[model samples]
Target: MSSTAHEAPPWLRPRAAYVHIPFCAHKCGYCDFASLAGADHLADRYLDALERETAAKLGEPHEVDTIFIGGGTPTRLEAPALERLARMVAHWLPLAEGGEWTVEANPGTLDAAKADVLAAAGVNRVSLGAQSFQPRLLAALERNHAPEEVGRAVAIVRDRFPRWSLDLIFGVPGSNIDDWKADLDATLALDPSHLSCYGLVYEKGTALWKQLQRGEVEPVVEDVEREMYELVMDRLEQAGLHLYEISNYARPGHESRHNLVYWANDAYWGLGLGAAEYVEGTRTVNTRDMQAYLKRIEAGESATGPNERLGPEERARETAMLMLRRTILGIDRADFRLRTGYDLDTLLGPVIVRFVGEGLLEDDGRRVRLTHEGRFLADRVLCEVV
Candidate 1:
């Protein structure tokens, strides 16, 4: 696990790369990503700067195991622009054999031309942002796409890609258990290979958060939200998808390898506006301001905004926190020690024993994982662990 003076550490040799696209056709009310709405004029310019930044970061083409292009709807770009973006990424970051290249798309923005462009660019996986199957819930979330658009998008993705994933949101304001059940049923009918079901979060400064404050929206009660999550676990598991992470489910062999790099706290390369990269125990994020990122790249300056270099102890604790998010394979004691150079018992023995007594975690001496009941209070458990 340790490296010699002349050798490069394993964490420094990242196999995953993430590229951020910051243009969205319509910015959702609840979103806080570093994306711009009605910024179509800047699309080409953004890609121009992205090309420069990628070239600067990667002087020579680097092969990676997973490459994810995510953002304010990567599909929002015109077909030609999309093709340029894809080609640029492929040029700078060639894929390793059997590597997974994924693109995030919105149902409203995807079309046959765009889908074909992605497929032709070596994109083997597509994760469609099908937030919900219910019209009312979609409207409540300020989603521009109609419920029917999801099916059409899925059909296009299925035809071109080997495997695809769908994202669903529960606990939307005014939603109930029946509505959640209906959404689950509709999602299963799509026969998606992967699913990410998340609870709606009303982050501060978002339109939805303001509505909650002004009494314009009635947020889902905590108990109801918990019930919706439990239902998702039950329904998805019964449908043959394994709960790989707390919010992510996938059929065997279809799990998101790109995201798994994150849950395992492995190093990765993040490029473009507001993207964050971690390598050699240091994490740096590009500026969230699009113009700032462009100017920095144009001036041949660092686009990094804020960064931190974690010491050994900080990294070990963080590694534990992230690894615990994997519901099925939690933390392997031997692997943890190998990766972090820290003994699991010396770091978190007391915390583990306490939570295990509370029936929130299970430690069979070899692996440590959250139990079924522990998942409901995972956030609380994780907070205490860290």
Candidate 2:
């Protein structure tokens, strides 16, 4: 694709990379990501194939500004395997100076030895999956780790990684406002550099969804869920953490840069099982099936499955959906045009006008952003605009 005159500093290279590790001790009932449980027996084989795939797909060292290794739980691997995985990534995806390297960890899987390996391999950030501090909530979420393990994991991360993030989930089947507030307060006590609070979504095919279907469980009422979200916003802001994106709060200069790459619709490299990559106007996803991915790599065949070349107009609409997630900054009119070659108003003028009149968005003649009321209805607004 040719760059438009408005595309200042056009993307010529990818600065971010994502590597997926699918092995986990247990798969949570709500997870739909590409992750395998009781797959430890295949760990060595998986790593071997991962190494070959990395070398084949990204020949030579590619310098990246950020590399995020997400799970089934990257820390699920034993010490030796964990070290090898870390080193393989470092060799193929070398980090630029002051680059951010993050690894996702489960509280039950992370230990002192694995933490040491990550720190030694230059990992600077750890995202701990601490769903909730309440035992009842934890059981409801089907998370394996005890609430106390979360504090232990945080201690390990704090002693090694310079920056760390904590994750919390709300609106579980039986949770109430008091339970939600306690979770928030416990999270605040940890004093993390970053925090992500998400309302639970029941995806089809998951155990949780099945439970809901069988009448074994009922989701939190919509009214209570809305209240939980409002509480998170107020509490995090009061803690001096600014809302950089919906569901994400960070201290100044601590925003997730890799995620920002996605929100800005910039190019990035993705590797491993079910990973998706977008570069040079094309999007491709690796095979989601573990055995199939391994077979393709061993046979020296392309592991990529579904792929698409996004057209200019389609890319522009998608960009609007993503950039709107940054509630504070929203969409800058000039920058949107520079990045997508489509004037914000010319492309979606009528839709924006409707939303602004509805008090779901703020159009200040310079930028288009979500209103406080709109944040609660973000999904509806984004759906209409896109």
Q: Pick by TM-score: which candidate is best?
A: 1
What are the RMSDs of all candidates, in order?
2.8, 3.1
**By summed lDDT, which 10 consecutive residues of candidate 1 come out lowest?**
1-10
TM-score, candidate 2, is 0.96
What's the CA error at residue 48 for candidate 2, in Å?
1.4
- Give TM per candidate: 0.97, 0.96
lDDT of each: 0.91, 0.90
User: Residue by residue across 1-386, what tens digits does model 2's lDDT show?
Assistant: 21113222324357789999999888888988999999899889988998898888777677788999997899999999999999999988888889999999999999999999999999999999999999998898899999999999999999999999999999999999999999998999999879988999999999999999999998999999999999999999999998888889999999888888898888888899999988777899999899999999999988898789888998999889889999878999998998889999999999999999999999999889999899999999889777
- Residue pairs clashing in model 2 are none
- Please name the candidate that would achieve the greatest lDDT relative to the true structure: 1
Provide the clash count, candidate 1. Answer: 0
Task: Write candidate 1's Cα lDDT for 1-386 as tens digits.
Answer: 21113235446667789999988988787898888899889999999999999888877777788999999889999999999999999888888779999999999999999999999999999999999889999999998999999999999999999989999999999899999999999999999889998999999998899998999999899999999988999988999999999999999999999999998898899999999999778999999998888899999998997679998988999999999999988999998999999999999999999999999999998999999999999999889877
Collision count for each candidate, in order: 0, 0
TM-score for candidate 1:
0.97
